[model samples]
Target chain A: MMVSLARKTLLHEWRRFLPAMLAVSFATLLQLLQAALVLGIFGGAAVYVSDSNADLWVGYPGTQSVDQGRPIDGDIASLLEMNPQIESVEPFYLLDGDWRGGHGTGGVSVFVSGVSTRPGAMMFARVLTPALRARLAYPESVIVDPADLNKLGVQVGDTASVNGHLVRVVGTARGLRALGGADIVTSLQTARMLDPAPSDSGGPTYLVARLRHPAAASSVVADINGHSGFGRYQAWTAPAFARLSVLFWLFNTGAGAGVLFLAVIVFVVGAIITSQALMAAVAASVNEYATLNALGVGKRSLRWVVLEQAFWVGACGVVLASVLAALLIWLAHSNNVPVAMQPSVAAACLGLVMALVAVSGLMAMRSMQRADPATLLR
Target chain B: MPYSNTVIDPNPMLVAENLTKSFTSGQLSTRVLDDLSVEIGAGALTLISGPSGCGKSTLLSILSGLQAPDHGRVLALSESLQAMDAKRVEAFRLHHTGFVFQGFNLFPALTAREQVQLPLQYMRLSAQEITRRADEALAEMGMAHRQHLRPAALSGGEKQRVAIARALAKAPALLFADEPTSALDAANGQIVIDLLHRIARNHGTTVLCVSHDPRLISHADRVLTMEDGRILDDSDRGAR
Candidate 1:
């Protein structure tokens, strides 16, 4: 009955609570979108490793993280393939190259990932259909995300100059989303054409190693690292490398801190708005609460009523936010904004909102405590 | 018949002993009740009358277990109200006490029936029984036709009647009214006073009323007049 009374009272005075509802909804929307965008950036940073078929990766020595390492000798691929636990080691090159837009405008950053022209030798081969995979055989031909066409001012058939070398766009990769700039996948020969002297000639950024025993890949990495003869090189299982990349982007750069700081400010503002609105509602109903106290309702029960009110308000806000977030995710996907709306992020945001409202409820309890039955006698 | 302060009343339903209550706002302090003692009998309408600021409401508040005295104790139906903890006192009030205020004090959002059902909801009664009893109380208050109306839709007298119905719905052993008719017209005040009298006489519920209206004292079975936080006269018209 106490809960029912609380619910009924809130519904009865919903007009008074509308401001609180809007505040909560706005907070939830901003938090969800910001967090989702950050997670999306992290996903984009680690996409090369996460979506790859290789179990182990090799990078230059003192490589603190992925996408930040120098090119290692391409011979490391043959040396890694000599291990009994290793299957095939493929040479891969990733570099940020300057590109001239189709309209001959200023230079724009383009990420060029170079792989073997042979089928099944590239990271994206697994995600591509056989028709698209077969097209990898054509030299100087590269794949780009369709969303990047407008960003690069180039279409599927347009020719663009990369590092002052011309390259042909053959096909589009559906899920090859990038954060800082457009991503292009090309054959090793074409990548060499674009940048003839990348570190040493014929050297690749990393050597991706497939494994005979996938689960034992980390142990193999440890064994390979123990060998001092492999100079200026570090070996890592793919997932560990992905984690390094995510951490590098999250804490090593200002992007993560900037997003997190904005989220915290939003959370605090949301909590204050909600708490003040609820306190106002409680103040308005002080006389009714005092009458309840005089009629023998416990102070504890009265607190529960206020807490329940906050809970319902939070719950309704979250529901509305979820719907709004779903629409935002759809629009982002259609427009290729690269936002990751992980279910775990949504759950965490829900917990945050509940905590915010619960604290507000506790703050509102102070008003209820002052509801003196003696006031009613006056 | 006039009763002396020294005389003990028999078969008392409530008793107050040397209750001293004082209010302080900064340096200014006022003693509302100074060593006051009183006994109220069951199944009667007892009216406490005084001019404004004579401590009538304070005494009512302390006696009804809504406020505590600076010193002294209250015993209602042989239970030590002052000795009990806050939770126990709340339970005691829930089971034994009902209150009506001069302002009606009804939840403006609730209909008359819901206001009457509020107390019964705390009693752990079944929904059917609570509804039945609340409807019965409303009917008895002559508000059967207006049970669906909120306080804003009701007149002052009608709002007071709903407040009375809410008090009566719980079937309390003691009913306390703090100027129940002070906000009404003469006709409505008389109607409320008559209804309170009927409730006390017919249901055997002890009704304690705090008022300054001389017109109301005539309807009381007993009248206690207070001055300077002390009872100056106690007249038992029922005994007469």
Candidate 2:
């Protein structure tokens, strides 16, 4: 009966409560999209290092993120080979260049990652599926993500000029969505050839290190970090590098702070609207609450009723918000917007809305407690 | 002092001793009840009638455990209403007392049946028993036909009847009514008064009502009249 009282009150005042429900729904939508935007940017920042088939990453000492890496001596691969825990090292070459597609697309900024194709030695190249991997082996061949299809306006078998060098489109890959416009994957020689450098200018920008035992990556990283005269190069366990990359975008840049500020604004606005709506509903029924108190209903029971009402309104709002958020996410996805919605992100958003509901319910309960049963005598 | 209405029952259902209550606002204080004592017997319809603000309602509130006195104590069913904490007072009211209000304070969203069943739900009765008691209470109040109607859909008299049913559904040992018929017409008020009489006579429930309506005077077994926060007259004793 205590539980049903809340349900009954909500059902009784649903018309008046609709505003609260809608407020909660709108709040949920804001919370989800805001979280997704931040998570998407974070994901984009770390994708390059995370999708690699390496247990550790070797980069320049000041490289706060993978994208900020500077060129290192390619001979470090031979030195790292001496480690007992070392498995294989793949030198990775990354460059940014303008691309001209044969399919009438204008110049667009694109990033290229060069991967070693030596048998069992291409760690970064493992990101491509087997078919794309085989197709990328051809000379002057490159692979792009499916999202790049519309931007590059070139598909499989099409030709694209990267920095004035014509490269054939071999195949496409997944999870390679780019942060800085578009990305392409090609063999090491082709990638180096496109940007011919001084013959003595060391090696690739970074090294992808596979470990014999993945758990020993920290020890390997420590050993590499301790190596003398390695010249500005830093080694990291893969997870650490990924976290660093995410943190670089999140704190090192103003974009993360801007997104975080907007999310806070959205959360506060939604919470205020929801709390006010609930408070008004409770205020209107305060007389009935006093009568209940006079009838000997416990304070806890009355408190439960208000809380249950808030929960019902919040739950309804979440369901509605989920639908709206899904449609918005789908539209953004189709438009190639980088709003990522992971299951964990959605769960977090839901948890935030529930917290809002609980706070509002408790606030309303404070007002309910002031209801004097003596009012019934009047 | 103890004022008698007929022979005072040796075993009283409720007793008040020098109960005094006052209200203050913005540096002004008015004594609502001034050291007045009263006793209510079991199984009788006791009416406290007086002009507005004469403290009849205040006395009812104190005696029923709805409010505490400023300087006195109330003993009901061998328990101290003044000494109990708020939670215990609420529990005592839930198990031993019931109330019918002048406003017919029905939840607008609940059907008449639901309004009556609200009190019984807290009693830990089986669902069937709750339904049975609710239905019987509504039937006794002549509200059976309109049990499914919400308060908004019910007439003034029907709403009052539903409130009465809500109070009576718990089968309380002591029932307190505050101007229960104030909002109804003469005929409807008479109907409600008849119901109160029936409840006291048939169910052995102590019914204490505070009202200004003189029509209630003839039906009450004992009528206590008040003036300036003091009992001015007891009909059985002919004087205070």
Candidate 3:
């Protein structure tokens, strides 16, 4: 009987709910886009952190994010390896550099990391392209990110210069998008040759160390920094540094805050539009509700009718919203717009629509309780 | 019809004692019913005839449990109407009291059969039971052929008969008709009055009709005449 009643209400009063459904669908699509932006930011952060397989990062003290890493001297790297608690220490250079690929119409700056060929820290991000490895992989070859394909206008056989060092771009792999802009992977030998004062440049901007045992991080840092000569360096755990870097990217500017504020506005407007539609339906059926009450229908049953109508409106709104959200998300993704279609975002949008329905149901209840049965006779 | 089912204990179907009803219009108060007392017995047709402004409709409303009198009591099957709670009165009215309005209160959207079925919705009857009851009521009112017709398709008099069928669909203990004949012409009014008599005799249902028409007085088993909210004369069939 309740189901039949719902069908009658939805069938008869579609105009009352269509606006609300459309509003919710729009909100859902925007929410998906917002989620995609959030996902891309976080996904990119994970890739950047994992690419560096260093167990411990020893940088300047009080550094919240790796983007804010302060430079330390090469003397600290030298004195740190002398400690008995340290298993191994390798100095690595990290910086952002621009590339002119395919005649450099739109210049794309990429993050460059200098690495040693020996098996040590920061080996996980090593680009493994066989063709490039056999040719100029040692000091003459460089790997560019896939993201720079259009911006840099480079192909597989393009040659690019880095800091006055004429280098050939042999292979195209993953790990794009830099702190300022896409990564241009360069060898430590090539980077040192381009950097002229490489020896005096503080023995790699960061000295990464692997703990002999996982639990010995604090003791190792303590033993190394306790030496009077290495007082300038700061040692941080991997998880801590990764978390700091993500926080820096997320909260560094007001970009995330602006998106959240816009999302809230959309949600509020959607809820209002939905409630107005439901309220209009209730008002139109006011006389019928009174007639039903006069026919000796219980207040609980009348209340149930209002709630069931609300359920129908919400259900229709959610279905329409889901389809529209999917379409919009697909359109954005195909157009190369960053939109993460995560399950949580879908669930949240659904929950929001249902919540609007519940609030409108509550509004309809007042009519049910207050409608005088005698009014129909009048 | 079985006598046992139609006549329950042979008591009066409705009793009113010293009934007084007043209405507050704007700032002033007026007495519509003043200590009115009456009894409508089973298997008999009782008519209350009065001129305009005689409180005929008000008395009917009080009798049908639609309105409460200010300082009097009403009873149905010896059950006091004034003392019972509002919900109980409403339930009793729904269960045992059927009302036919002068305006022919048929839902415009419903067909004749559906109109009759409206009064039976509160009852826990099976689909077959409801349909059978609706058909029987319409047939008794001589509206069997018009079962599928909407109120818009029916004449003014035919609409009143449909209203009667809807009221009788519940087989209520007492049928209250407020100016049932006022909305019909002389010939149609006679047909409605004859149907009331047949139902009273054949079904043993009590009939209490409120009307101002002198033509309706001839068919009544008993007539109570009122003037200016006062009963001026009470007479039987010969004195009618």
**Tens-digit lDDT track for model 1 on B66-149?**
889999999999888989998999999888888999888777678888888887887898998898889899999999999988
Give per-residue lDDT, candidate 3, residue A271: 69
lDDT of 2 by residue, A89-128 (tens): 7888887878999667899988888887665554444467
Ranking the candidates on lDDT from highest down gives 1, 2, 3
lDDT of 2 by residue, B1-240 (tens): 222233335688899999888999989999999999988887678899999989998899999898889998999998999789988999999988888889887887789999988878877888888999999999999889999999889999999889988899998989999998889999999999889877876787888999999988887878899998999997753123
TM agreement with the true structure for every prediction: 0.90, 0.88, 0.67
Judging by TM-score, tell me the better candidate of 1 and 2.
1
Error in Å for residue A60 of model 1: 3.9
lDDT of candidate 1 over A198-309, digit per residue (tens): 5654688889988988999879999899877655689999988987888788887788789778878877888888888888888888877887788888888888888988
Q: What is the DockQ of each candidate?
A: 0.50, 0.57, 0.16
Backbone clash pairs for candidate 1 read: none
Local distance difference test values of all predictions, in order = 0.84, 0.83, 0.69
Off by over 4 Å in 2: A1-3, A78-88, A98-109, A118-127, A145-175, A196-201, A209-233, B1-8, B124-129, B237-240
Worst 10 residues of 3 chain A by lDDT: A1-10
Q: Name model 1 segments beyond 4 Å from true.
A: A1-3, A50-56, A61-64, A73-89, A117-122, A125-127, A150-153, A193-195, A198-203, A209-240, B1-9
Give candidate 3 misplaced runs (Cα > 4 Å): A1-3, A20-95, A98-272, B1-10, B17-26, B30-33, B42-240
Top DockQ model: 2
- Order of quality (DockQ): 2, 1, 3
